[model samples]
Target chain A: MSKELIRLRDLVMEFDGERILDSINLYINDHEFLTLLGPSGCGKTTTLRLIGGFLKATSGEVLFDGQEIGDVPPYKRQVNTVFQRYALFPHLDVFDNIAFGLRVAKVPKAEINERVHEMLGIVGLRGYENRRIDALSGGQQQRVAIARALVNRPKVLLLDEPLGALDLRLRKDMQNELKRIQQALGITFVYVTHDQEEALSMSDTVVVMDKGRIQQIGKPEDIYNEPKNAFVADFIGESNILDGVMLEDYKVRFFGRTFQCVDKGFERNEPVDVVIRPEDIDIVPASEGHLVGTVTAITFKGLNYDIIVEFRGFKWLIQSTDHCAVGSTIGIRLNPEDIHIMHKSEYSGMFGDYSSYSAEYDELTEDAGDEEE
Target chain B: MKKNNAILLSTPYILWMLAFTLIPLGVVAYYAVTDPVTGAFTLDNLAQLRLYMPVLGRSVGYSIVSAIICLLLGYPVAYYIAHRGKVAQKMLYMLVMLPMCMSFLLRTLAWKGLLDDTGIINNFLGLLGLPTLRMVRTPGAVIMGMVYNYLPYMILPLYSTIVKIDRRLIEAAEDLGCTPVQVFQKVTLPLSMPGIFTGITMVFVPAVSTFYISQKLGSADTSLIGDVIERFFKGNNMNLGAALSLVLMVLVFVCTGIMNRFGDDEEGGVVV
Candidate 1:
């Protein structure tokens, strides 16, 4: 009767004394599309392996349907994994390959044939029953791998960057295809990828990780618009982080000026990083302004112009519909609703004691915290 | 490859085949169908083919039996070596080759001594109060020599084949719910067919043409084709010898063709 499908409790994984995954705790809800997003070697694949029962956890327990499966081999588990290489059996034709698991389970021959055809139809490989695996194109082969995994009707599916070997265009198209499949089946899906755009577009919950730790877990919009720490804000999308202090409950200071921001959860005078998305900062005419600055450069970004402005030894990359040429003075205004104030813990690591990381950022936020004084 | 350049690239190998294999067979052919005194065609030698065909048949039958034994014994040894660690593999490979360092005559002599009527095995049988076994100068001795001479030939190729197969293919089968036995049946055996084919051809073809192993171990009554060919050549019957030689060459070609046609393409794996 429980809705939770998988629970990973404080999992720790180490291989030969090298810690790959450190104390990971999470739960996967039924029918949710979740993504484990991180850079390479951040233990995303290790986590998936632990859940699939391929690798045993050092300390934690993985419960599927309220049953502990720490000692079970991968085949006995109800979860199935699609490897990056597609791992198709080359000797078996398309139909035999899909029927492999069913036959192994001692299913009746007639039923095995029926399920195999049904699976092939589901994966859009209806007519490729007799094709050799090596003879099929890369895209068609991927479909067989999917059908092979789904034929047994696993309760959850884990894909370890299955599209990593695909070309960019094919990978993008498969991303949408995977989403469609998950929606149709209503099965819990755990996808792992380092591509930020792919994670944001397809995942219901994006769990961002770094350096063997979970940084944040939230909806895609919250992770993008309101990052909790400097790491999350920077990793999710580009943000112009500025050093600032909370002047009052409703106001913050940056760029030698005070601006009213909607984020208000700190004592007075706490150090913060102000995040304003490129689209949030408007490029107004020079006469009307919250702050006036000179445009250092302009870049054409297909639909709009990215205007780089300098003021008070700070620079901001603002995107706007009203075009501004390089070397022109411009007025800039930060929309309070779009202002994301982050704590200083995240940016300290980036700056290496806050200098080398942001010499570029220093020019962008030269007047930080002056509005309060 | 383009047609012109493909032929150009193959010229050296083609010429080499022509000189060594085709040229000798051509001479044998010419002599098999000719009268030495008149350079005229005669069935005199061809008419004697019926007399030697039975010996040819026995040789083929004997070789197939010995090769089967070689395969059955060699397969497990090759599989163990291929799956062994790097150091173990090298050591086992060297052990297999050590017997080859001595001349084939020496190895066959040792086998003859062991299987003689009053030899070590018969003496042991007498001591055990069992009937003194008959082993030497019989069909068994010829088979023993065939298997011993070519055991390494069978092992080496089969080991290399099994070692090169993609282990992931086997793992994929097991992961797809195959019991270990089913995995071997569906994946390992099919993948290692090429290695079995290699070992069989390497052993059987040479064993059929073998004269020394048979003569040393078998009785005079065993009329194998190898002994017949040996007698015709050594006894000054050149016409009969040339005819038998041509027959053996054709058999080799036919066997090689079968191997090329049905050898395991997935032999990129270890001999399981």
Candidate 2:
């Protein structure tokens, strides 16, 4: 196992008296691919900049190799960045651009030349040493940028949405290529992006953030399979979050039915949020299911069918390979292992009960009628 | 034939150019080749350039020196203005363009008052018990006048181009083991070459052909090619004047061509 290479303790960042990052604590292991995953304005990019030394935190300590690095300049730090737009020098050709850092350090001429050529070959651009930056395609320019940063052999590489500008096919190709390179070099990689699938496929540890705070940090499987809060469940994948009550140990009550569960230690009739993965719900005949519902919509997703069913006025989204006809009654079954429970937060008494919503809607319409009369 | 509306719309400008630009150039060419009084072609007018060779040399030298001085003084100011806040940028623009809005001759005359023997500058120096200095009517004074009048030409274009450079590129360079000074040298300086070329051309072309500034600020010993050309034409020596004018145009073309080659030619011209 790799040891801890970097630690962020009690970090806080503010811009114009408004907080951007609030009291974040994290530890990154050496040779591990750690990803900061969040939506826009969620402080993922701000956290990356703080680590890269481009922006200073309001209060905190950034410890590297068991020592605090207090506002040291970027040039003196042991990290490099691949910017979002692939900020290559337009004035220099590929060779000279890749050789810029080495020349600044006054490296020997022969070594600079050899290392640049090696980088070119590694990036699969052996004959593109003299091409101008604007002449290359987006993917090719991205490779050159990677080569320029990696030629210096920095201790950590910070990539800030480096694949954001590429199309879907090229993005997947580069994602696999980046993982291959990171393993071969065995350097710490701190990647930042809002693409959930990209983070899930590439990261060893995913830190999910929302609104300037970290909600959860775990392995990809743990985050997807067992989220701690409703936000993490909704952000990572398509989740059917419902309002339920824990009747007692190993049992929960929802939709007026009590089902067996593996969770314990909740107060009797404690209100909780239930997370059921779409793929975990199995569709069966009416007599074999615990609850019966009608299919409202069915969409072909090429790999699987995304079907929505309505049971007790609550819509359930299910992903399955079996085909189901719309406007047909169906029964859905859930196993005890598929039901995960968590304490209600931010979204309590607000979901899985359609009777209250219809009641409110009826009240509003009646008020409008009274006003007209 | 096709009835094109664009050709009809451009007819006025075509007539304007033919009447004002091409015809006058043709007349100058005719005068440079033939004697003005006798309708006979001769090379004597072109050969008379030997008489004014020193003035031609001095004109080229002063324009080059003044262009270099404008660059050295204007670059830092342009850089500072480009990096300023929004309110400060607008205020700096007003300050830079305020002098340009006044009449050019009026500004040169104002400089004359400031540089005279008993001018305000000398009076202030006398209060400090310093001896008076002579600055009027010398080559140095002529170059100074040129720089003072044309400094904005260098600053404006440089500002427009430098402001468009992506700030992310500088940050990326700094993240990749580059100090702040190295970031300027490696990224900022090379990217702003288009503005530098335009600024040099803007200052050099007018400085080489100016006679008013030299007459208003310099002594008799600092007679430039413009002074000789003006004298020949105003005194009815049109043939020699036309030849010298053609030579001056050629010299300006060659100097601008060399400067353009030094700029990064891929970048298009900055509008300002």
Candidate 3:
């Protein structure tokens, strides 16, 4: 394992007597692409700011290479940030903006030119040196922002939703481009983004946060397939969560049926939450399937059909390539290893409500309403 | 019918512009190029402006000095006010605008009264057993009047523009290895160019052409082109006064053009 280059110990941040980041500890290894992923208002940006030395911790230590850097100002720290709005200096052209840090350091003019050109090439904005910041499109401006930060060549690059302003196509393209750049440079990147797909696709380690606290920290697959609680499962992707009971060892009971799962170490008759990915559950014939339910809705998703089935007053979202008619009874089969069981979490009861599904159901019914015409 | 109604509704505004703006300018232009009595075109009135060269030079010098002083003083005050919280910002803005609500003539007269030998300030100095130096009718007093009366124009524009700057740029600069002073010099100063241009124009235009402040506060030795123009306009020399006014207008245009070039045009070029 790599050495820890940045460490946050029991970090707490408060604004106006209200907590923004609660007591928390995190470590980022050197040359690792770690991403802080969460929804809005989840304090991911605050955590990144603390690490970037832009914000002082209310009570805790921010250690860089085992040295406390809480009192260090942002300029003196070995970290740079690409702000959420790109924040490219409107007063300077693209070349000067990318060379800002080097110029402030009084770097030789010849060297600043070479490095700035190199950064422009890296961001694929070679001919945009003289372009005014406001004249460029949003994606082009974002590239300039990235080039400006990366030109500093700091030990850690903190990006705060850098691609949030781009459209879907550009966001996807930049996601791959960012991954390629990070890999080539091998710099420690602590990226903050609310887009789960962005985090899953690029991060070496994903730190899932919620309400000023970390919910889970693991690889993308672990976070997606083995979320420790309901919130993580819900936040990361679509999960069909069910209230269930663990019947000791690997046996779990849900929907009036006991099923075998890979999870163990639960006491007999223990209350638990069960999560199964929509794509994990396979669609079999009604007679051959383990569970039977009536299909309430179906929508074409190009790659797969997103079908919602109601079983025992609970809706299950399943992605299948086969065509299934609405209001027809269908059967779903779950593999033993696909059933993820965990102890009840704070968000377990808050989710899985029919009212929460009202919007999607309304859209589905609207299509049906249109079909009837 | 709707468009016609809209055009008819704007008729009063058109008439107002013609009466207050266009007619006065036409009259000035006519007087500037023609002899007041003979109604014959002449360049003699324009050439006669050279006789008041010393007064014109003094006007330019004093306006430059006042603009520089306002900039040096107003920039820091505006920077401080921009960083203040919302409530304090509103209260301080109200305080800055309070003096502007009073009449300019009255304010200049109040300064004249305060600077006189037997006025409140001199009396206070007398009670302190200090010498009451001569300042009532001097170029220094006139410059002081200019600075005091036009300082608001400088402060307001500077404050508004500085506060509108995206604060994240400063933070990003610092994050990229800029010290606090470097951040200010690189980010804050360059971004505040628009305000500087606006403030300089706002302060310099009135300071350059101010007649009452010079008349009320300065000696005859410190007479500016404004005083010369006022004298001609009052003493039956309308053509010459009109020519001098045109010269001042040209000077104002050249200075504004220079300021506009120096400012960051992408953000805000001219406040007006």
Candidate 4:
């Protein structure tokens, strides 16, 4: 197991009597890429700021290398941040920007030149040293911001949605580039983002958060395949969550039908939330299905069709390569391992319903999410 | 068509500048080069400027001192106001500008009244058994008057520019391991250069050419170029007065030019 680099113990942050982070306890491993993923207003960025020493927890201890560092200012901490807006100094050229921390430390001139040039090459902007910040495109500016933070040689780097400002194609490319840089440098990275796909694709460990609390923290695969609660299941990916009851070990009842599942350790007849991933469900003939439903809507996503099936009064979105036309009767097959079950929590019945799903509404909520923090 | 419409909309402003600005400048130039009585072109008015060089020097010297003082005083005030809460910022900015609503002459005269011997300040000092000091009709009093009258000009520009600086830039600097003082030196100070230059220009230009403050606050030994120019014009020596005005204008231009040269490398170069 890797050694712990930073730990937040009972960290609570309150602004004007309103709690922003409520007793967040987390430990980041050395050289690991841990991501805090959630929608905006989930205290993910606030948590990142507390670790960066930009914010002080109202009541808790922040430990670095097993030493309490809650009193350390941001400049004294051994970590740096790439701000949400990039925040490159407009007055400085690319070279000076990358050389800022070195210059502040009063590094020797020759070493400053050598290290700045090396960082420029690392960020793939070698010949563009003299370029003004405003002259660069958004992607190029993002590279400069990364280069600026990385040149400080911090023990841990905190990135708060650094790729949030980029377009889709550029964000993907930078996502891979950031992963490569992190692995090559072998430094711990604490990244925060609202983009689930970016978190899943780039993180070794993903922390799902909501309403100022950590909903789940696990490996990316574990987080995706076995969410701890409905909030995590809904936030991580598209899930068809249904209120279910555990009849016995490995047996769950939902849609008034008993289905075999891979989950256990629950009390007999305990109420649980059943999560079935959209892509995991396979469409079959009406007679071959465990339970049948009519297709209420069909959205053609490039690789697959998002078919919303209505069983009785509940709507479930199922992703499949094969298209089922609207008003057609279809059935979904769920393998035992494909079913994920969780104990009911505060977030039960709040998400995973596709009855009101619309692409425009999703985008509207995404835009609203961007304005939160 | 759009460009033509823009030009058409700007025609009135262009006409106003030509009438009140350019034409008046031309008239000044004409008066400065010609003999007053003969209406004949001559360099005699310009040649007479050598006699009053000390007065011109005093004006430049006093204005430079006042501008420097305003900068030292205004920068902190501007930074403080910029960091205030929204309502407090507006209230503080209003307080900075409130004195400007009164007439400039009245404000300077009020200072004269307070600084005079046996005046309000001296009377208060006498009640405390302190010796009366000679403050009125002195160079210090004149500089104080100029600084008092022009401080708001310096602060307004500085506050506007400082407030516009992105707070994230400072956080980014600190995140890059810059201490508080280093953050100001590296980020805040350099970013506020435009405002500094603008404030200097705003304060320096008016302070340099102000006749009322010096006349109201200074003795004969402290009379400035503006006082000289006013005397010449009132004494029916329009040619010499116009020549002095031309020289003062050139001096202000050269000073602002130097300030702009130092400031041009930064983005959003000096506002005025």
lDDT tens digits by residue: candidate 1, A1-373: 3388888888888888978778888888899999998777778878887887657888889988788888887667777767767788777899988888888888999999899999898889998999999999888888888888888887888887777767779988888888999999887889888777888999999998876778888889989988878777766766767788888787999777888889877889887888878788876777888889888777676888766777765667677877787788888777789788877874443521222323544443332111100
In model 2, residue pairs whose N, Cα or C atoms come closer than 3 Å (at least 3 residues apart or on different chains), thus clashing, are B137-B218, B137-B219
Off by over 4 Å in 1: A243-258, A264-269, A286-298, A305-317, A344-373, B1-13, B35-39, B77-141, B217-224, B264-272
To one decimal place, how large is model 1's interface RMSD in Å? 2.0
Please give the lDDT score at residue B244 for candidate 2: 92
Two-chain complex of model 1, DockQ on C-alpha atoms against the true structure: 0.39
Indicate the docking level reached by candidate 4. high
Instruction: Tell me the DockQ of each model, to 2 decimals.
Output: 0.39, 0.74, 0.88, 0.87
Regions more than 4 Å wrong, model 2: A347-373, B1-6, B126-129, B266-272
lDDT of 3 by residue, A1-373 (tens): 8899999999999998989889879999999999998877888989988888878889999999999999999999998898887999988999999999999888999999999999999999999999999899999999999999899888899998888878889999999999999999988999988778889999999999989999999999999989999888877777788999999898999989999899998888999999988889999889988899998878897999888898887888888899899999988898899899988988987654333465844532231111000
Candidate 2 lDDT score at position A14: 90
Off by over 4 Å in 4: A359-368, B265-272
Q: How close is candidate 1 to the true structure, as a TM-score?
A: 0.84
Q: In candidate 4, what are the lDDT values of residues B86-199, reduced to their tens digit?
A: 999999999999999999879988998999996899999999999998998899999999899999999998999899999999999998888899999999999998889889
Tell me how much of the true interface, by contacts, candidate 1 captures.
0.44
lDDT (Cα atoms) of all candidates against the true structure: 0.80, 0.86, 0.89, 0.91
For candidate 3, what is the DockQ?
0.88
Best by TM-score: 4
- Assess candidate 4 and give its lDDT: 0.91
Q: Indicate the worst ten consecutive residues by lDDT in candidate 2 chain A.
A: A364-373
Reference contact recovery of candidate 2: 0.78
